[model samples]
Target: MSLPLMPKATAVWLVENTSLTFEQIADFCGMHALEIQAIADGEVAIGITGLNPIAKSQLTPEEIQRCEADPDTRLKLRPAESHLTRARKGARYTPVSKRNDRPDGIAWLLKNHPEISDAQICKLMGTTRPTIQAIRDKSHWNSANIKPRNPVTLGLCSEADLEKALAVSQPRSSSIFLVRASEASALSQPAAPADTGHYGRTEPQDAHSEAESLFRRPASPAPAESGTETDPDDSADF
Candidate 1:
């Protein structure tokens, strides 16, 4: 049976730009929705089948170039070689498949916001400070090759939500009021005792003594009465 003609690009574009549901598109292409989804996710081969055929030649050279230039537009694309292929090349290599290529938590934090500190990243990811430092060092974790899982893709947060989180995670400068040991000791010491009259052996002065010292007056002499008595006697004789 001859296969029907359908371009992979057309299918991909339909998935992205059309209002039609995946099921509808799958039905139109005479394929299962899961198949269409796989094609969209770059997890399956998209080509002509017994009932469905891909019309790749239908796209203009410019359209093909555009698709190649934009990675987002490319569907059903895979890495050039698998780990097995690399091993066959006779080069000693670690199998990329065995390891998580995803960036360490700190790398993700730094990539998203260049200004973020290691401590801040550690706090945000709930990871250790040393782990964050190791990620930043690029010794064990190569930031350039590591691909971070998008928070949006993971459904952990939206892009806007991440922005807010970054804002909240920023280190705030705070003024700490610290008291020196000497200053604290000075403040804690008891006040000196009030001055007393005894020399070399000071005693606590009473309130009365304090008041007298604060406010005291000198004594005045009594006035004479002889001159006044003589004037009264002269008046009685007259």
Candidate 2:
């Protein structure tokens, strides 16, 4: 267990103000239960003042309440945020050599991801708003010479940073665009009939028409020898 600053003082405060047990206080303050009991009885540290753990950011009122409600629960200190969780403050810096490439990066972001805001571009490329605006309005001194180049390729920012910035700018367009794209793709495809013949071909064949063609009998043989016949008794002299 990690003890709070001024452990005796904090213990004194908890003993005076809360309904927590001596063991809970001891466990939280890293002191023995007997010491906490003596502190509660005002037999030790007679002149010491109570220090509020909430004010010191060592604990939350909710945690105190929870522990007080259940004597078995021990107090837990509120966690402090690390540097990785904190947002950076102030302006970003760019090297002198890379400063000239800012315009190209800005132009690339503007042309490719117009949805990105001026503030986002400034943060991503370390350039000022005026430069962005001048480039946007085609008024930059080197507007004719400036080419739209990727910030990551130009070493202005990492691919991860660029992707993070793009993610922040892309949420609004996601749902509707996906729905429309799916609908367009569905419409472009042709619909197939229910009945298909050989060679993967689809043809409409009505049940009645198919039945008539299948069960219809062949025509009777035509009347034979009605006009001409060969005589069996006739003979010709050689």
Predicted structure with the largest lDDT when compared to the true one = 2
- Give me the overall lDDT of model 1: 0.48
Residues 40-72, model 1: lDDT tens digits: 786765442221112222234454455546544
- Point out the worst 10-residue segment of candidate 1 by lDDT: 82-91
What are the lDDT scores of the predictions, listed in order? 0.48, 0.82
Candidate 2 deviant stretches above 4 angstroms: 1-87, 172-238
**What is the lDDT, from 0 to 100, of the residue 96 in candidate 2?**
95
> Relative to the unseen true structure, what is the C-alpha lDDT of residue 97 in candidate 1, on a scale of 0 to 100?
49
> Tens-digit lDDT track for model 2 on 49-102?
677777657788899999989988889876653112334577777889998888
**Predicted model with the maximum TM-score:** 2
> How high is each candidate's TM-score?
0.28, 0.37
Model 1 spans > 4 angstroms off:
1-105, 141-145, 155-161, 169-238
